[model samples]
Target: MEIFLALLGFFSLGLIVWLLLKDYATPALAFISVSISVACILLILEQLGFGVGAA
Candidate 1:
């Protein structure tokens, strides 16, 4: 499950880069996308027992 989330996060990061490079996303949109992706990655990490907050 951790590996899956890592892969998903990697893919999402790549997609965000691609969108920016391809001129498909505005700066605001890209920022929003990245923020959401980071949030999801953090959530997944939490679920996998590697979160920042106290248990």
Candidate 2:
């Protein structure tokens, strides 16, 4: 489950980068979109009791 979320985040980040490089998104929009995705991933992990410091 954690791996899935991690992969999802990775793919999302990749997509965002592609969009920016392709001129499909503004810098601010890309930044905000990535930030929101990261925040959502963290929240999901936290809700699942997966702390960043955990092994």
Q: Which candidate should be chosen as best, given TM-score against the real structure?
A: 1
Off by over 4 Å in 2: 1-22, 52-55
Residue-level lDDT tens digits of model 2 in 1-55: 8776775677587566756664667777777766666666666566578948432
Model 1: how far residue 34 lies from native, Å? 0.5
Best by lDDT: 1
Backbone collisions counted per model: 0, 0
Candidate 2: pairs in clash: none
lDDT of 1 by residue, 1-55 (tens): 7676675777587566756654766778777666666766776676777989732
| C-alpha lDDT of candidate 2 relative to the true structure | 0.66
What lDDT score is found at residue 50 in candidate 1? 93
Worst 10 residues of 1 by lDDT: 14-23
Candidate 1 TM-score, true structure as reference: 0.57
